[model samples]
Target: MSKAEKTKQHIIEKTATLFNTKGYISTSLSDITQATGLTKGSIYGNFENKDEVAIEVYKYNAGLLGKTLSRSFSDEYPKALDKLHAFVDFYRKNWKFVFSNGGCPIMNAATEADDSFPALKNQVKKSFELWMSKISTAILEGQKKGEIDKRVNAEQYASLFIMLIEGGILLSKTMGDQSFLNHALDKITHMIDHELNILPS
Candidate 1:
C-alpha cells in the first residue's frame, strides 16, 4: 500500500475499538489522536473530517465482525444445520472476545446511531441488511439441500435470529449477566433443532 493508504489504515485500526466502546459522539478527535499518536493535522490530511474518519472506522469495525462470522461458517460443518450450530458455538465460545470489545459492532453502532449521525446510521443499517440477507440465504440454501424445513420462512427466521442475537447481546451487556446471552442462544438452538431442522420420521 501507498504511504497515504497505510497512514489512513493506521488511523482506522487505532480508533476502531475506541469508537466501538465509546460511541461516535462521545469519541472526540483528541481520543483518536491519543490512541493513534497522530496529530490533528495528520488526521485531517488523511480524512476529510471527523465524520468521514468515523465512517471509515465504522467500516473497519464492521469488517472485523464480518471476518469473525465468516470464520464461524468455515468448512468444519458440511451441512447448513451444522454450520448454523457452528455459528452459535463461535459466539458462545467467543464471549470474552465479544464482551471485551464492548459487544457486537453492528449492535453498538446501530444503537448509538439511532435517530442521529445519519451517515453512520446508514452504515449500521446496511450492516444489518447484509447480516439478515446472509441468514436468509443460508436458510434458503438449506431448504434446497433438504437440511432445513421447506415450510420455514427464510426472511422471517433471518430477522428473528438477528433480533435474538442482538437483543441477547444488549441484555447481557447492560445487565452484567452473561447467562442472558446464553439463554438467548439456547432458545435459538431450540428453534433450529425443533423448528428449522428436518427430523427423520
Candidate 2:
C-alpha cells in the first residue's frame, strides 16, 4: 500500500490494545506515541485527530475478532448447526486471546463509548448488528436444512447468544476467572442441543 496507509495501519495496530485496555478517555496521546514510536506530529500527520485515530483503532481491534468468527462460519463446518457450535467452541478455546488482547473489543468499546464517545459507540453498534445478523442467519439456514428446530426464534436466540457471550466475557474479565465465560458457554451449548436442535426421527 501507500506510505501513508501503512503508517496509519501501524498506528492503529500499535494502539488498538492500548485503547482497548486504557480506554479512549484514559489513553493519552503519549500512550499512542509510546506504543507506535511516533511523535505527536507524526501521529497527527497520519490522522486528523485523536478521535479519528481511535475510530480506526476500534475498527482494527473489532476486525481481528470479526474475521476469526467469520472463518468459523465459513470454514470447517459445512452444516449450520455445526457452525453455531464452532462459535461457542471458539470463545471456549480462545478466551485467553480475547483476554490478552484487553478483553473483547466490542465489550470494551461498548462500556467506554456508550456515554462519552459517540463515534466509537456508533462503530460498536454496527459491529453488534453485523454479529447478530450473522448468528441469526446461521440459525435460519439451519432450520431450512432441517438441522435445527424450526420453532426456534432466530433473531431472539441471536440476541440472547450475544448477550450471554458478551456478558460472560465481561464477568470473566471482572472476576479474573475464565469459569464465568465457560458457564455462559455451557448454557449456550445446552440451549443449542435442547432448545434449537432437531431430534432424529
Candidate 3:
C-alpha cells in the first residue's frame, strides 16, 4: 500500500483497539494521537475527527468478527450442519476475545450509538441484518440438501440464534463467567440439531 494508505491503516488499527477498550466517547483525540504516535495535525491529516476515526475503528472491529465467522464456515466440515456448529463453537471458544475487546461490536454499537449517532446506529443495524441473512441462507441450504427439516423456518431460527448468541455473550461479559457463553452455545446447538432433523425415531 501507499504511504498514506499505510498510515491510515495504522491509525485505524491502533484506534480500533482503543475504542474497543475505552469506548468511543471515553476515548479522546489525544488518546488516539498517543496510541498512534502521531500529532494532532498528523491524526487530522488521516481522519477528519474523532467521529471519523471511530467509524473506521468500528468497521475494523466488525471486520475482525466477520473474518472469524467466515473462517469457521469455510472449514473442512463435510456437512452444512457441521459448519453451522463450527460457527457457534468458534464463538464459544473465543468468548474471552469477544468480551475483552469491549464485547461484541454490534452489541457495543447498538447500546452506545442507538441514541446518539444515527449513522452508527444504522451501520449496526445493517451489520446485524447481514449476519442474520448469512445464517438463514446456510440453514435454507441445509434444508434443501435434506440435512435439515423442511418444516423449520430458516429466518426465524436465524434470528433466534443470533439473539441468543448475542444475549449470551452480553450476560457472560456482565457476569464475568465465560462458562455462560459455552452453556448458551450448548443449548443453542442442541436446539438446532433437534429442530432441524428429519430422522424419525
Candidate 3: how many backbone clashes? 0
Clashes of 2: 0
Which TM-score value belongs to model 1?
0.96
Q: Model 2, residue 143: what's the lDDT?
A: 97
Model 1 Cα RMSD, Å? Answer: 1.4
Which regions in candidate 3 have their CA more than 4 angstroms from the true location? none
Which residue pairs in candidate 1 have backbone atoms (N, alpha carbon, C) closer than 3 angstroms, thus clashing? none
lDDT of 2 by residue, 1-201 (tens): 999999999999889889998997788899999999999999999999999988998998899899999986885888987899999999988999999978998988898889799989999999999999999999999999999999899999999999999999999999999999999999998898888989732
lDDT of 3 by residue, 58-117 (tens): 888888898778765564775768778888888967877777778898888778887787
True-structure RMSD, every candidate: 1.4, 1.3, 1.6
Tens digit of per-residue lDDT, candidate 1, span 1-72: 999999999999999889889987789999999999999999999999988988999999898888778764
- Best of the candidates, TM-score: 2
**Against the true structure, whose lDDT is highest?**
2
What is the model-wide C-alpha lDDT for candidate 1?
0.87
C-alpha-based local distance difference test score of model 3 = 0.83
